[model samples]
Target chain A: MTSTNHTLFEDYLRGYISDEEKKRLELVLDSSETEREEFDLYKTMRRTLSPNIGNPYKERELKEHLEELGKKYTHEFSNEVMEMPVVRKAGYVRRILSVAASFTLVGLIGIAAMIPKNTSKALAQAYVYSSDSTAPSRSVNGDNLITSSEEYYLSGMQAFKEHKYETAIISTRKAKVGASPELIQEIEWLMALSELGLGNDAKAKELLTEISTDTKSDFSGEAKELLEDLNGIMHRISSFF
Target chain B: MPTAKTYLNGIKQTSHKVQHPDQKYIEALRTNDMILVEDIYKNYGQMITDLVKKNNGNAQDAMDLFQEVLIILHRYSQEGFTLTCSLKSFLYTLCKRRWINELKKKGRAETLKVADISDLNFAEESKESVEGTEMYDQRFRFCKEKFNLLSPGCKEIIQLSWRKQEDGKYCSWKEIAEELDMSYAYIRKKASQCKARLIELARKDPGFKNL
Candidate 1:
């Protein structure tokens, strides 16, 4: 039950009172049904509400009357929708369409047409987009890159997860198409897997050694194990031959 | 013994621990990162605007909250309080608290809990404080309207002279003449006239005493 000093409820953790104090206080207020009711109200109010407090802010922006909050905040946003596998395809489709349209516009503008001329490349680009292409690709760059597709690479990922290593590698290789050298790490892993499945032990060892040297993670652990297996096989083959 | 290089290394370690946040390329009114200030605006701006309307506030009231909310954040971070919750939830609560405090300060007596604020979290952190803030903002808007109804020359004089201090939370009057492009003697007389007019408006308002 609440005392007349119900204002404590305004503070964080309801002032963190002891259970004995709480019970004694409740008993005191319980003397009157009205007091008990007030106590209950405070208790209920506390439960229903969250206790975190204080304002969050930056001095510079507040002065300008909400000038660029939207632009600034979007950068901090986690890109949750893009992260979900279900929505990722949608993100890809949106990116590709946007990119295609951008390209077509760019191409036509090069010819000095202001009406946003249409182009076959744009149409082709849109056709192979994730939504219509059924090739299951994603972008190598951030979701904004549309002209070059990551559809085949994404398909490789799906294939590998399905334990179809050869197909996955093939798909991964296609994914690397037109990609910057800064990229290709993810696709290269898949490509190495393709070689391993095709019994190309030497190539697999080379790829595994390179990846493991650059970084170490759960994936690196797997590559190391595979390297050991292939090295053992090569030793046995040499001895027998 | 850690000498000049050692002390420098210690400072470097502490700096790394602190992540030396970036403050480059500030655009006007952007507040997302250093204090998690930008996200606060995005998540709460609409809610505050809506709350104002629901409780007899106008778009202008909504705009004021945006400025005030950002100001409060600046104050809190400058004081070095850790933010343990999402920006959305934190901002909602602060605005609500400001509204309630403002109303209470005005002496409006319907003893209402934060419950009346639908936007605020009833359990305190479950949701943002839109409800509570809206309630208070509604009253502040009422106050703003009353302030606006005063003589325009008076209003213009007051606003032109109004300056947000370093912290941006407290408003005070100083050098009104410089701000208004007038002389000290002229400002003194104009301020007196403005004060009386303001008093009369407050007297006539039903919510003024409560406010």
Candidate 2:
């Protein structure tokens, strides 16, 4: 270990060394063991003293940056956001879905706040999407999958929840277009289940078979199980016939 | 101009690499040489985001990875290191290192056998950045905390001067003077003074010193 080096020495080591001084320091480093050790200690101390400055854009900075970037992409953003299947945008889905999904999550602080929370209808609508009957209009000419059609799917989800088996079929079928292949299978499963619930085993079997083939994971596995139940229902129906 | 041309050439030559660097829109990133590193965030950003997301991380992980790899590349440059592999590969290796260290720190270290080697190999001629990226990352965080404590004016002047390099030679004293609208000597002197104050601040903070 060497004796203390001053702040000037620290600065020089902190990339503040001049060309002449750099040469001189190099000579000094070569000249003696004590000088080398001193320089080494100084280097270590400067590095130890040097605070690692992070990159300029921190998380909040990036968030602001993203907002700025988002503005530039506004046309792209609005077009995509409007096309989002979830209906709600990134920052505000919860409030809209709260009243929309059902009145179940709506606490006792209810219709006194506004329209009364319809508990029975909301509960019955729990398993299914309620039907709005409006199919999102698709414009294939412009590569637009009719956006107007989602109303049916949303309604079907609500209708299934309310145990409206017949209405659930109509709403879900109407909402079925423009969804990805996976959701198509899911909608098929829902439709089949509702039909079986309404005692239409033959129609249920055909729809359930369609869902079983979409096989891509847990959801498909459940569809397969339901299909087996539908087959069992078919055997009983045939026996009665 | 020669150095800029050389870097541009370096970018062009890297096209055939195992990992292609993305550089179609370089001007978006505020960089002295966006030409060299443009492909970096574009090619590897999502892969990192996906990796982190898979491991219970989030967009914050992507930010950390992006910044740390940059600091690592900058430090290597300050040490006169050369690039061997395409920038894409080097960035991939550096980001993976940062992510691995972060996971270990989180106390749920699951070192998956991620199959990615194209980015880890550097040209044999370029100096190894085999060390101190982790250290610099910590140091940078410390410096940033201290930076928050500095006078706004000091922070501004320091950042402006720090970004003055164009072809990696401080652009020009005259240009900087014009930009700052001050005499050349004044710009140089004020920059030094601001840097000195930054050092003093760093020196005093125990956390900064640890980094």
Query: Interface RMSD computed for candidate 2 is what?
Result: 13.7
Highest lDDT model number: 2
Candidate 2: where is the Cα deviation over 4 Å? Answer: A1-241, B1-38, B41-50, B57-90, B101-130, B156-197, B206-211
True contacts kept of 1: 0.09
Q: How high is the TM-score of chain A in each model? A: 0.32, 0.35
The TM-scores of all predictions, comma-separated, are 0.28, 0.36
Cα DockQ of the candidate 1 complex? 0.05
Which lDDT value does model 1 have at A239? 25
Question: Of the true interface contacts, what fraction does each candidate have?
Answer: 0.09, 0.00
Docking class of 1: incorrect
Tens-place lDDT digits, model 1, residues B1-211? 2222232133124222221122111111233343444444555566654444333232344556656766544433332323434444555566555565655664532333334433344226523233433433454455456556878787765444333345743232344566667776676567556544544565476665443
Supply the global lDDT for candidate 1.
0.45
- Interface RMSD of candidate 1, in Å, is 21.1
